[model samples]
Target: MSKFVIKDDFWELFPQAEIAVVVAKRIDNTEASAEPVRPDIIELLEKANEDAKKFITKDPLSENEVIAVWRDAFKKFKTKKGARCSIEALLKRVQKGKEVGCINPLVDLYNAVSLSFGLPCGGEDIDTFAGDMRLTVAEGGEPFLALGDEEYDEALPGEIIYKDDEGAVCRCWNWRDGQRTMLTEDTKNAFLIIESVDPGRSGDLRQAAQKLEELTVKFLGGTARIEFMNINKKEIPL
Candidate 1:
């Protein structure tokens, strides 16, 4: 039910980068002996605190049946809770954020992997995705999605996101689209995105995103179009 594409245009951004287009099929690795979370993933999680730390959530997923993790997360929206202040506010706390609430699987994957990698993770409705994607430095004043259909007053505009034929897939590098575009129980095919500055240290975060995609395809009976990009620094040397 999902499919992903990495356009040729995107390759220009990582021409010399040694990156891995890794795919980790699913996220229900709860067994005591299952593949322990990748080391880098754990490291990233350990680096966050406060609201940033608040991103991770526990959702019971199994390899045989990885359904919509977000379905469970919707229940929290009823509390009238919202996103952290600016990205800066979120960064300040997640270095050691204790879980304050629950979230769905896709979100939990982003948050959990984020905690260990110290990298921001996000996604959008691939079904709603319109065109080619690009990543750039933030303009700072760009508007972003807080959750669901709500938008925030801020953004990391100079940063990067998987922009499609539409303006943005989500908001550059922060929060993402609402359930309207999010993957659901009915999703048969999906598009995914995960990025970073250095591909070497980013395998785990990349893998986590893949896991979410793979798990979805299994339980939901669809396919996926996964795009793992390494947004190299324009100034960095090979």
Candidate 2:
């Protein structure tokens, strides 16, 4: 079983933090399409966009309840908020009348769930990970390659990131995934991470995680499993 741990430093900053990890194996990545949009996935994305229109119309992206929570978290970890986290970026795009476009079946499915639930959700190809993964503040200089970028970037000190024994897998907590562990058409196993800082929305987090697992199995032809971790329970065995 692979081990996933939330470092104590992270809990000290956000005691209410929670993460849901969904693991899927034997995924059929051959169906992945960079330009194809699944009708079912499009329906979910459209509905989420419609639902988000109401909240964004009432207030700017910076003032959104869900986005605000993450903004505060970024501040606590010494990183800027907007244009960082996946959920915030998605909301910002929808707020401006842009639809989240499809990438691949796995990515599209998770993006739909993240938008529908208003939470930060991302995943990595598990086989690429070196060892057990940990969520903690960076000490600086960890290698990172943002999506579509060819050159490597360095993580800022004190920024929150997910790292394995080798190096950082994600920089700025749900902001961007590193190319080293990104999910690709060849990925056969993956670990998806959904995060929440609002204690009151634990139910929403679980619901989103369940939906992610279902969608992964439905579209990727894999067996899925999920494990939940919070301030109270910091570790889980895969």
TM values, all candidates: 0.45, 0.92
**Cα lDDT of model 2 by residue, 37-125, tens digit:** 36776676678777766546447667888888887778787563443778888888898889887666788788888888889889898
Number of backbone-clashing residue pairs for each candidate, in the order shown: 42, 0
Per-residue lDDT of candidate 1, residues 128-194 (tens digit): 5444334443344544444545544444433333344434445433344433346443332344444
RMSD of 2: 2.3
- Please list the residue runs of candidate 2 whose C-alpha ends up more than 4 Å from where it truly belongs after superposition: 32-37, 80-83
| Clash pairs (backbone) in predicted model 2 | none
* TM-score of model 1 vs. true structure: 0.45
